[model samples]
Each structure stands twice: as structure tokens, then as C-alpha cells.
Target: MTQQPEKEAIITVENLEYAYCDFKAVDGIGLTVKKGEVFSFLGPNGAGKSTVINALITLLSLQKGKATVAGYDVSRDPQKVRESIGIVFQEITLDRDMTVWEILEFHGKLYSMPRNERRIRIEELLDLVQLRNKRDIRTKYLSGGMKRRLEIARGLMTRLKVLFLDEPTIGLDPQTRMRMWDYIRKVNKEGTTIFLTTHYMDEADMLSDQISIIDNGRIIITGTNWQLKNTLGQDIIYLETSDNIAAIQLLRTLPSVKDATKKFRGILVSVHKDGTKVLPKIIERLRENGISIDTVNLKKPSMDDVFVYYTGKEIRDDPPGKNGTLTHRPGGS
Candidate 1:
């Protein structure tokens, strides 16, 4: 047997921490994002997702611990880290008065890109983001989606290895969000590592190759979507019956059933393999035991289900400004 080589980490953090006054915004969290991977930090508002990103990108000073981006130490080589990565903040930072072309051209110039090369790269990125037709239009005139696409284009102005997108599609419609996802996929396919943070479960589920669920300034869980869901281990069988307690005990003893528990008024069983195959036997056994089942359902776990399972609550977009700097309220995990 041969051991495979480990994938190189493009972004690495070790016990990273940041604080404001007495509040520890990012509490000793650490993660690694592999080269060309779409790594997402999924959490509610003010879960310290943004703070961690800020630290990684060298925007916020690291109060403690260490981080490296694109092989450059964040603290020692902030400029190198900045040059190696691009950032799209939660707030739009585009110049509304400038044309899309002008904005990109300016960014390219700021990076000291040669004129001819800048022109060619701008054209390529404009087409890549599907905004060639809107290139001459002022940014203020472009729709939210177009502006976002332009921001993405601008982020790619430099030859970057990593791109950080903070809540990239928070306000877009479903169609537009899908379009953004397509663009993001295309970028990732072309080999730019994407590091994004979003509270949207579906967005994380669809876009991320690796996901870390952060809550109340701490990482509650981290894994691929399937890996995270598989931690629950087996499909959930829900039964609303005449006697929940008796049904739980009976279901738990079955070889095909992994575990069974009482959920509210229903008996929730974790079925070992094919839930459909086990359903008939469950029903038969319950009937034989004189247990009357009123309703039955077998469900595969979703990322949202997994999120609630780990964090003990669903993701919520708490309004900004209500709680000063940190907006998310701490919940049981």
C-alpha cells in the first residue's frame, strides 16, 4: 500500500484569535483551505466569519495566533498576502461614477499591470463574467447583479491565487444568485481558490468543496457537505404512533435500526441501510407489538438539517446595528 501526497494548503490558520475591547470576536479558530478548493464558512450574522476573513486577508491585525495566505505569513508579509489574494467585501466598494471598464483598468493599473497586458486581461475577465456588453456602462447604472459581476471581475484584475467573497449573493434574486454561482464555478474551474462566507445553507451546500460551520465566534463543525451529513449516520425514520415510548424501545432493538429516540410526540429511528427496506419490517414489528402508527416518514438529512443538528438552531440573518459590532446572538450548540 502507498500513501498519497497531502494536498497543499493555500490558506492556513493556527489558533487564530481577534478581539474588540473585552469581546473575543474570533475565538481561537483554525482551518485549512486547499489549493483550488471552494471553502466556505457557514454561520449566522456576527458569527466571526467576517472577522476571520479580515485577519486572513490582512485587513484586521491579528491579535493572537498565526495565519498564512498563499504561502505568505499574514503578519510578516501582509503586502505579499494582499497581492496573492483578492477580496469582495460584504459592502459594495465600487466607484459608481466610473464605467466598468474604467474601474477594472484602474484596478489593474493600481496593481502595476502593463498597459497591453491589462487591456487583454480586462477583456478576458469581462467576457468571463459575461459583462462585456456592460463594459462601457457606468457602475451606478448597472443592476445589483451586474455590479456584483463587475466586482468579481475587478477582484480578478490581479493574478490572484485566492479570492475571498463575503456574502457574495445576499440580496440577489434566485435567478441572479444562480448566475453568480455559475460565474463562481467558472472562476473556480479556471483555478482560483475561492474562500467564501455565507449564512445561506443552500449556497454553502451547492458551492463549497469544504465547509466549516461557525457559531458564536467558534467553529462548531467542519467537513465536506456529504461528510458532515453522514456524521448523523443513516436516514431518519419518523413515526407518529399511539405509544411513542414503546415504539422507541422496540425500534432500538432491531438489527436494521441503529438508534431510536423520542422526538416530541413521535418516535424517531435511525435506519441502518436502505430506509425503504427497513420500513416494512418496522411497520410489521410495530403492528405485531400492538403499536398503532398513525403517520410514517423517512428522510435523508440535508445540510440545513445538519446545521440545526450541530448548532441546536437554524441560521438567522440578524439585523446589523442592533447589537453594535457583533450582530449574531449566541445559541446552544
Candidate 2:
């Protein structure tokens, strides 16, 4: 049997740090993104996700540590790094007056792509994004989802190795967000390595090949979806009992119970052993103690659970405009 070759790292960082005067936006952190993989920086707002991306894309100058993108050092070869990657900002950046085709065409031109090549690429991208019919319509007339698709199309105008998407599906409806996710999957399937940052739990859960959870300017954890969840325990059991306080205290004494936390109506238990076996023991113990079980649920750990377990708080999705830095243009302008 032949051994498979190891995947190459397309992006690499070492002790990377960035600051805004006195405030450190990104602490001494390090990460690696492999070729043809959808790597995500998952974090809440103000976690320095955008700052790391900005530096990689050459939008912000690196102050400390070493980093490389597409085989070029970001500090020494910033332009090469920019040329090797495409960017889709968190906010919509289309010119209200420009047509879909015009938006893509302008991008290709701005990068000095040949006239014939630019036209051909525009046609291909329009078809790829499923916007052929809306090619000539002004962007102001397009819906939110349509505008997002257009931005993605513009990002792919050049033959690039990586695409940086900073919260690509932020303000869309649930249906549109799912649809956009499909488009992103298609892009990855076609062999473009993706590096995206997002606050949405489901977005990271569904889209990432590998996820790095960042908070307070530091990376708390990094792993595949299942790998991260597995850290919590074998299974999770949510129990609501008549005497919640008494129940949680009793739950902690069980050998199978790894840990327990008091919830509003009940207590959530993380067990090291199979929940089916551990569950019966829980019910029997509670019944023996005269505590009545109101509700019981058993499931595997989810990304939400993993996040809360590490961060010690629930992740909240910030509303679009509350962050103030919500609106951003491509090229870090």
C-alpha cells in the first residue's frame, strides 16, 4: 500500500500579534491553514478575527511575529500576498450604480487583467454565481442575498489560491444564509482554499473543515467540529427536576458524570460514559432522593456546547449595526 502525501500549508502564522495603540487586538497567536481546506476563525464580535485577516490580506501592517500567505511573507511581500488572495468583506461593498457584470469587470480591470481575459472571466463568474440574468441590473436593485453572491463573484475574478470571507452571510435571512453556504461549499469543491471569520455558530459548524475559536484576542481552541465537541464528554444530558439545586448537587457525585452546570430550569450534565447507562443511574438516584425529573434530553455535544464549555459564556450574535465596524470595503479601504 502507498502512503498518501501530506497536505501543504497555504497559510502559516507564528506568535502573531497586532495592537491598536494600548489595546492588543490579536495576542501572541499561531495558526495554519492547509491547501484546499475551508479554515474558519470562529469568535464573537471584537475577538480580533478581522484584525488577523486584515494583516494577512496586507490591509494592516504586521507589528510582531511572522506570517506567510500563498508562499509569500506578508510583511516582505504584501502585494504578492494580496494578489494571491481574494476578499469578501463582512458588509456589502457593491457600488449601487454598477451592474453585476460591471462589478466583476471592474475588479478584473483594477488588477490589470487583460481585456479579453476579463470579459471571459466575468461571464464565467456570472454563471458560477448564477447571476447571468441579473448581469446587467444595477447592484442597488439586487436583494441582500444577490448582492452577497455578486461580492463573491468579484472576489473570484482573479485566479487566486485563497479567498478571505469575513462574515460572508452576516445579515441574510435563514434561507438565504443556507443558500449562501451552498455557494461557499461549491467554491471549496472547485479547489479554492477558503479562510473565513464568522460569529455565527451554525455557520462555523457547517462550513469549516477546521475551526479556531478565538476570544479576547486569543485562540482558545482549534480542531475539527467533532474533535472539539468530543472534548466536553461522551454525551450531554439536560435534566429539569422538581428540586434543581438538590439534583445538580447529587449529579456531581456520580462517577460517570464528568461535570454538571446549573441551568435556568434544570442542570446540564456532561458524562464520560454512555448516556444510556449513565442516564438510568441518574433517574434512579434522583428518585431515591425524592427529586422528580420534569424533563430529560440526551444528545451528543454540539458546537454551542463546546464553545460554552471553553469560554465560560454563551456566544451571542451581535446585531449588524451595533458593532460600529460592521461596514467594510474590500482591500481594507
Candidate 3:
């Protein structure tokens, strides 16, 4: 009957806010990331994800509230916070002319890593990323996946308590993204806390120890993937009927039906009881009301469903000035 102790927080934010001129990008938001976990920030583009990250990593000055990373205050000890984290940007940032080994080696030097230490870390990372054989190849010659691996490797050149991965696999193919996930898992197992922002729902579902979904400069929900999905109900039934609006309204009248939301082409119903039991009732009720059912799909809730249920829309590409990017230096200055 004993409660478990809370894990130590490696990153903490309290009523954090940031704005671009008069436009507020990050509203008063607060959350904590425990040590040694892959914590994902899931949001549509321009959802203030980039702004919050930029603040936590000390790229943007804190305009209000507080944030601490690796035990250093982002506002007061920005340099210390920077030194404790490594960043992999959404865009590929390697100098095409530089060799793989040189990219990592130069990053180590930038952080003032000692000569022997830099060499040792370089070898260790190249091996870790499976780029040992291509160590001497110029980055431009590498495939997209290879370039991503190199970027991850470069980020780890210095010893870090946390790694900030911004859209880490944005442009990679599915198979390569899976491979990158493996590398990321290995890194997390090795004890570095991973703070991830990603566009892929499957990516967040598969890799996150915890997830926070942000929208319009605010966090909509924060929980494990299962926790978030469970909020919708035991099962979800997607229905496309002759009268979608009336179908959703009648669905809400069922005692077993938890809630229903209208989708573009259908309505999604969440059931408190077994969907099989609820499904029959749903069809009969609609029939009584003269609503013809064209389609009915039953399944467990997914991350996509959870996102839509809460945000009322699908994730979209960020528009300019909503979540703008800056060229990231591998290790913070």
C-alpha cells in the first residue's frame, strides 16, 4: 500500500511563456521530465513546441516564469544548461564538405573536449551510430539516413545529461526511421535523458516514456501514450451514416456511449462498455431515427485518435512565424 517516490526531474518548467513581438508562441505552461526517459513533445507545427524547446535549450531568452535543465536555471545559468545538453536539429546541418569523422571531431573541439577524450568519444560514437566504416566519407556522399545518424553522433560527442532532438527523423523513410529509433533507444538505455519533439504520431507512441501534446501555445494533455488513449474510452467506433450530425447526437444519448465527435466524413464514438454491446445499440438507435449507417469501424483508440479527440484536428506543418527555426550549434555556446 506504499506509494512510489516521484522520479527526480531533470527538466522542469513553471508557468513558462514566450512571445514573438505581440504574438504569444508559448503560453503559461508547466511540466517536468524525469531523468533517463524519452519524453516526447507532440504538437502540430506552430504549436509553440519550437519556442518552448528554444527556451529550455537557452536559444531564446525567458520572458516570464521559470525553467531549469540539468539542474541549472535556464535564465540564470544558461551556459551551464547549454553545456549539459546536446541538440539535433530538424534540418540536416552538416557541412557537405566535411568528413563524418571530422564533423564529430570538430564538434568535440568546439566544446573544448580534450584531444585524447575527443578521439575516444569520436570512435565510441561512430561505432554506436554504425558509421565506423564510413568515418572518412564526406557527409554529402552519405544517404539521408546516414546523415541523420551522423547528426545524432555529432550531438553525443560531448558527455551530456540531456539530448534535445528536434524533429529528429522528419525527412527519413519509414525503415530508416525505425533504425534511428533503435539508436535513440540505445542512447536512452545508456542513461541520457531524451527530450524529443516529433511530428509522427507513431514515433511518439513507439518511443515515448511520457508525452505532452501542445496546441496554441498551451499543453493540452500530458501522459503516457496508453494513458492518453484511455481517456477516450474502452473502444472507439467510427461511423459514417446518412446523417452524420444526427448520428453523433443520438450516439451521445446511449448510456454506454461515453462521447461522440464529428469527423470530416464520419463520427467517432467512444464507448464505456464493450463496443460489441454498444455497437448493436448504436445501429438500432440510428435505425429507429431513420439514419442509415453506411460504415461502421470499431477499434481501440490510437495516438492519432487521441490527438484529434483533444485538439479537434490533425497535426499540420508549421506556418512561418508560428514556430520558426534558428541554425543550431551542436553544443551550446
Candidate 4:
């Protein structure tokens, strides 16, 4: 019988650590991303998401540990690692004066692509990103979403094995963000592994095959969305009642309910079984106890809930520094 070969990791980090002056930005972080998987580093502004990404992509020097990208050691073979990966930064980097075509053409040229092959790849990428119609238009004239799409296309010019996107859809409108996700999915389907960082819970839940939640420069948890949500072990049923205190006490007695508590303006009940099935019973029980419900909602455990459960705070509450600037370790450090 022939034995199957073990799959190799496309990206790997072990005991990685980095600091800014006396302040550590990343602490003993370690992870592995398999080939062709969408691996998300989910965190808020200064949680060292970018620092980890930078170190892996050779933007920052490894301070205390080992990391490899596309079979090349990040510290020893920075150029080889860079050649195997592409990056789309959080901030826009396009030249306003250049047309979308010009920008992509310049990138291909920098990689020393053959003119004919470069032209073919440029057209292919433009179509992939749905920017073929805007190819000749100046980048500055394009909408924020369009510019983002163009950046993604440019990032693909090198035939990268891994693509690093730092908050790819951060500032786009919801509809635009969704459209961008579609494009990203298309790219992923064609076999480039995606490594992204974002604070948006829904985005991470929707896009990632695997997720690692980082907080205060440390990884709090790592799992698939479903696995992480399952860790909560109960479904949440929230309802506003005429007598929230009474409802909470009544819910605690139900066989299906594991716990009950007052949250915000409602009573939050944790049920051992499916919340949807148990919801009607909960309503009926409340009515039997003479507690009138004003509004009721049942929510499956979401990535947002998982983040809060682990970090003890919402991701949005991670504020910037005193001057409203993000405090990140210098990339070269």
C-alpha cells in the first residue's frame, strides 16, 4: 500500500516575540497556516495583528523566534519569502496619477515579467477583480471600493502562494465589502492562501477557514468559527419582559435552561438545547409565570459573542493611543 504524503504548512511561526522599546507588542505567538486556507488573525487596532503579519512577511525582523513563509525562513531569506507572498496594506498605496492599467503594468515590470505574459496576466487579473471596465481610468477617480479591488489585483501579479491582507475591507460600505469578499473568495478558489487581520467579527466568521483571536498581544483562542462558537456550550435567548427579574428566576428552573441572567434591558437565558426550539417553550413558561414579554430574540453564538466571552470586552472598545494614532512597533524592529 502507498502511503499518503503529509501536507506541509505554507506559513509557520514558533514562539515569536516582538517589542517596541519596553512595551512588548507580540508575546510568544505561534501558529501555522496550511496551504490554500483562509487563516484570519482576528483582533482590534493595537492587538499586534499587524506586527505578527509584518514579521511573517519580512517587513519586521524576528526578535526572539522562528518563522517561515513558503518554505523560506523569514529572517534568513527575506527576499525569497517576499517573492512568495503578496501584501495589501491597511492604508492605500496607489499613485493617484497612475491609471489602474499603469499601476498593474508597473508592478509586473518590477517583478521582471515578460511583456506578453504580463499583458495577459494583467487582463486576467483586471477581469478577476471586475475592474476591466475601469482599467484605463486614473486610480484617484475610482471609488474607495474600486481602489481596493485594484490593490488586490496588483497583489496577485507575482503569482504569490500566500496573500496578506490587512483589513482589506475596513472602510468600504457594507455592500461594497460584500462584493470585495466575493472577489477574495474567487482568488482563494484559485489556490492562493489568504492571511488577513481584521476586527470585524462578521467578516472573520464569513471568510476564515480557521481563526485566531488575539488580545493584548497574545492569542486568546484559535479554532474554526463553529468550533469556537461550540465552546460557549449553550444557545442564547434574549427577551425583554414586563418583569425581567421574575423572568430570570423562572427561566433558571426550566430543564432546558442552563442559566439565566439580566443583561442590558432584557433577560438572557442560556439553554442547553437549540435556542430556536426552546424559545416557544420559554415564552410559554414566562406567560405561565405571569411575566409579559415585550420583545424576544434568539441568537446562535456568533464570533462577536465568542470574542467577548474570551477577551471580556468587545473588539471596538480597543482604543487607539492618546493622540488617536495606533501604537505599533516599528516595522524594521
Candidate 5:
């Protein structure tokens, strides 16, 4: 007999669907996270990333198909799903008046873990997230970075098989965000399945083992970060200035410009798919237009570029659909 794996899949989603009033939020979505992979759901805002997360955790009722977290069905066995998952919501969930240690301890008791085990887990997690020194401080007094770190510690209090983080470092500084990535990597290395959603391209690129780009309540693409990167036809050139009309005119004459759109006072221009080979020409054309450049950035086509290419909108703009409250679980944003 072939020796099989012992621990079963930690999460399964199949043909899942959800709608708010007349509009669907998640459309026939499906995914499965193995025992220890860091799987990511990425999208423009309001693309139903929250909707799917909510369904998976059993916070929102499933409108179609099925999902199982650990071994329990999402619709029929929500409590079981809850038992196996720990969540760090987009909206901060820590009790502001409670000390960091106190919050983790309180959350641990809710999961019915033994006192000894909970203590050990909390200590270990605090160190893992680099928060051992700040454990006694009340959450409200902590800096945004510190509070985010404490939330990581709290999320691990339950010894969860699946960890869900939604936009984990939205407003953090670059250093803090990078440190958080390191901590998240540490968690996945300890054999927990990490699931997260982010609108930030860099965060998704740096950490996700595989990424699913969802738009308009449906997944537009799903693959490893490299896979998605490789799929893009060419690189992108981004230009920012204080003149929208001038910015558009600046890019209009560039033979390499495949597409150009005015964004506020600036214009984001896409080079021809094969135009990446002629990078110098792109710049010369801009200079000819006399568009005084405020900022010029070179970027490979990212998940965001891929989303905009298909949807014709920026990542932050909410899609046209029935609006609904986005709650990924009980203590969520």
C-alpha cells in the first residue's frame, strides 16, 4: 500500500457563490489550501475577496456550492470550521483597553485550551512576532506596527491549522511591512496553512506561494507569483505629474505606448507588449512632449497591472455590484 499523508487538507472550497441583494459577490469560486502552504487571495478592493473569506469561515451563509475547513462542511458544520481557523481581520479586533498578553490569554480561553498550553503558546507567539517586550502594554497605547504585531500573536493563540489575515499591514511603514512579512513566513514555516488577502502588489508578490486575482466577484487568474508575472506580455512604465491633460499628451506620441490613462494629475502608460525591447525610445518620446516628469518608475507587470488590463479600472475602485458589509469572520472588518 502506498503510504499516504496523515493530516488531511486544511481547507477546501468548491463552486462557492454569494450575492448581496441582486448582485453576486463571489461567483462560482473554488480553491483548496494544503496542510502548510501560504495561499493568497488577491484582488482590487470590493472584488469579493472579503465575501469569499467570510464564506470560508462560516461568518456569511453560503449561497451555492460547498466549502470545508479542516474536515467540516462550511454550511453544515460552521463550528468545526471555526475551531480550526484563526483570523486577523482587516479591521483591528484587539480590545484596546487590554494589555497585549491579556488579550492573547483571553482569546486562548475562548478556544478552551488548557492554561499551561495557552501560556506556552502565547509566550512563544509573542517572541515569534517580536512582541515579548511589549506584552504588558495595553493595545491602545501601542504604535500601529506594534498593534499589528500583537494581533499576529493573538491569532496564533488557538494553535490554528489555518491562519487568515486580511490586508494585514495596510497602513504600515515599509520597514514594518517587511518585518511583518518575515513573521508571517515564520508562521508558515511552523507548518500552518496561511491564507491572506491584500490589494498591495508588492506584499502579494513577496510572500504568496500561489495567488488568485479576483475581480467583479470572479477569479480572473490564479497562479504562483512568478507564474502571473511571466504571463504578462511586457513591462510597464508609470509616470506621475501634476498635469493630467499634459500627462496624457506626453504619452500619446510615444510609439511604444500601448495604452495610456489619466489618473488624477498624472497618467499611467503601458508600453507595447513587445515595446519593452525599446525602452529608450519610450523615454525619448516623453522628453519630446515636454512633460516635466515629477516621478518616473519602472515596474514589471504585477497582479494589479493584470487586474487593470482586464477590468479597465484601478485596483482601489470598488466594482459595480450590490454593496454588502464585508465580514470575514466573527471578529472581522
Candidate 6:
């Protein structure tokens, strides 16, 4: 018998593009999300991550290239795309006046879910998000984390095949953030493909099976966490076993060495590039100085280093509030 070809990816975009005013928001970007995989679209602010997701959600038109989700053209069949996907945005959208149970019931009814099924769905979601205890409490009384869990549970009301979680744990406490991560994993295990965007490097490092690093509307890198980090924050150690000290002066001439600081018995070498690859030659130089090696250390940069390498900026450097007011940026990290 002939072998059957593998199925098409769950989502595909060909030269997909969009712009805002004079600044291009999404510049000929291309990506694919596989069935049942957690694919992350990661980038710093002003990098067009939000704009691309908005286009997929049908809030913006597809001005160039084609985008298809679950075999439905995003532009031509928006309703079908919407039905097949669930979205949990960065912003929390809920009425403070209503209790948790009311909002979930109302959300189900909006989709024309049958009364009996709506009840079953509500019970399941409440338990799924661990909110059964808060079902009757006003949403306003819940903490930041609780509200986020509610949003996740509410998204499941539609029984979606794909989930878009945009910075799902943005401003919650560390403990709360971990809780949200658990909830995300639980949902994924139940058979949902997820498209996640996040600024928390640690979260992205731990969660995404595959990640695309986007910068200023273009994808600059794509790989699993280990592979990608290897490209950026490489381990490089500074060494100077030379007591001759004159030889250390010659080592400073190398362009890759950023700064060489003299410590008690050795030097702490920082590099603009990987120093491990330069280790052998460095050892030879020390031997020429009649120096013998006693110690060497290797230190790799963190995910923060990877981010700066791509965008040339730090995520936390951005002003956290608008008009210098907290009210304008509630729950924003």
C-alpha cells in the first residue's frame, strides 16, 4: 500500500504582512503552528507581536500574503477561524458587578450553547480553573490571578481546537504566575494547540516547545529554548594564569574581549563574543609567557542576554504606566 502524506500544519501564513500608519507592524512575517504543540511568538514591546495576533483574530485585515487557520482562510472565513480558536488577551475583560458563575453562564449563552450543556460546561470549567469555590463571588473581589484563571476557563466554553494566550501571566505574583502556568499546561494536555506570546523570559524558557523570536516586525530567530539560547548567551570565561603580567597586556589587544579586570591572582574576562572557542589559543599565549594554568571558569548569559541581543533593549526599561499613572496600566508588567 502507498503511504499517506502527513497532514498540513494547523496554521500557516505565507509572506503575511500588515502595517500601522508609516510604521510597518508586521513585515512579511511567516510562521506555522502544529497540531497539539505550544508555539510561542515572543518579542519585546513595539515589536509587532500584538499586531500579528490581531490580524489572525480578524480585528485587522490581511493586506498581503495569505493566512489560513485550520484550513479556513483568515480573511475569507473569519467566522470559521473564530469558531475554531479561543483567545485570552493581555487585558482582563469582565464586569465587576457580576459573580463568576453569572459571567461564565452568560458567555456560554452568547454562543447559543444549550442550557443543559452550558451547566455542564460551567461546572467543568470552574473546576478546571480551580474556581468552584469562588463561583458565587463577585469577580471584583477576586485577586489578579483568580481573574486570569477565570478568563482561561471562559475561553474553554467554546471547545476550541487552538488557543491564543497573549501574555497570560503578565502582572501576577510569582506564586500566582506558576499557578497560571499549571493551568495552561492542564488545558494543553486536554488536546489544545496553543499560540503564546510573553515577555517573561523564564516563562517562555520553561513552557514553549518551539519559539519564534520576533523583533521590530520581523522574525530573527526560531528554535527550542536550549538551541536558541546557545546562539546568544554563550559561555565564555576570562583566564590569565600568567604572573608575567606583560603577556596579559597582549591578551587585551584581542577585539572580542570587551573588558578585562585584574583580580587577586587572575583576570575576569568579559566578551562580546564566545570565549570558549578562543580558549586553546589563549592557553598557548600563557605558555609562551612561562605561565601554567591553575583555574578557568565558564559563564553563559541568561535569557535576558538573548533578548537584548535581538532587540538591543531591555523589556523592563519601558515606562510601566501611561501619563505616569498606575490606573492607566493596571495589571501590566
- Kindly give the stretch of ten consecutive residues in candidate 5 with the minimal lDDT sum: 324-333
Which candidate gets the maximum lDDT versus the true structure? 3
lDDT scores for all predictions?
Answer: 0.82, 0.84, 0.86, 0.82, 0.75, 0.75
Whichever of 4 and 5 has more lDDT, that candidate is 4
Which one wins by TM-score: 2 or 3? 3
lDDT of 6 at 70: 76
Q: What TM-score goes with each of the models?
A: 0.79, 0.87, 0.89, 0.80, 0.74, 0.74
The clash count of every prediction, one per candidate, is 0, 0, 0, 0, 0, 0
Score candidate 5 by lDDT.
0.75
Superior candidate under TM-score, 3 versus 4: 3
Residue 144 of model 1: what lDDT?
A: 69
Candidate 1 local lDDT, 1-333, one digit each (tens) = 999878899999999888899988899898999999999987766678889999998889899999999999999999999878877777778899999999999999887899999999999888867889988899999876677777767876776799998877766667767877887888788899999987677898999999998877889899999998787656878789998888888888899987776655676576768888899999999999999999999998778667766665565544431221222122223
The TM-score of predicted model 1 comes to 0.79
RMSD of each: 4.6, 5.6, 6.3, 6.1, 7.3, 7.3
Q: Name model 3 segments beyond 4 Å from true.
A: 1-3, 114-117, 124-134, 141-143, 316-333
Tell me the tens digit of each residue's lDDT in model 3 across 130-231.
889999999999987788778878876766899999988766666767877987888889999999998778999999999999989999999999999889
Question: In model 2, where do residues sit more than 4 Å from their true spots?
Answer: 127-130, 173-179, 315-333
What are the per-residue Cα lDDT tens digits for candidate 6 across 11-114?
A: 88888878777789889899888787788887877778888888888888898988888779999999999878888877789899899999999888877889
Please report, as a residue range, the 10-residue window in candidate 6 with the lowest summed lDDT. 322-331
2 against 4, candidate with superior TM-score: 2
Query: Model 3 lDDT vs. the true structure?
Result: 0.86
